[model samples]
Target: MDNNGPAYHEMMELHEILNFKTLCLVKSKMMSGLVFDQDLKALMEKDVKQTTAAIQDLQSVYKPNGGIVH
Candidate 1:
């Protein structure tokens, strides 16, 4: 069987791979702690807030389609 075809096992494997990568990133960041000083932390927080607001704005446009399932 060609690996690129839309097979159920292949899809499940791809999902598992993506989830493992996400877990690795989260674990690595948690282990490192904050690598920034107070000023940098404030700047990062501001950026995060702005990015979050932007995402919410986009979501608002599509939210009526259906709330996020997860």
Candidate 2:
């Protein structure tokens, strides 16, 4: 049995969440093209923005002193 990696368990979890957020953003953008209603399209765009901010927050967990990841 071997359990060794660069990131800690909690950090790995955050990384995974960040990946999910990114995927969701991409999927939302992709599906936006199929959204016929103007309201729904706007909602999806808002979600994309929120998801982007969420990813940034999640990445900050890995940064020192809550700084930006990049």
Task: Report the C-alpha lDDT of model 1 over 1-70, residue by residue, as the tens digit.
Answer: 6543445654565555545545554554454456457666666556556555654544443323233223
Give stretches of model 1 more than 4 Å off: 1-5, 34-70
In every candidate, how many clashes are there? 0, 0
Model 1 clash pairs are none
Best by lDDT: 2
> How close to the true structure is residue 44 of candidate 2, measured as C-alpha lDDT?
98
| The candidate that achieves the highest TM-score relative to the unseen native structure | 2
Tens-digit lDDT string for candidate 2 (1-70) = 3434334556666667777888999999999999999999999999989998887777665653333344
Count steric clashes of candidate 2.
Answer: 0
**Ten-residue region with minimum lDDT total, candidate 2:** 61-70
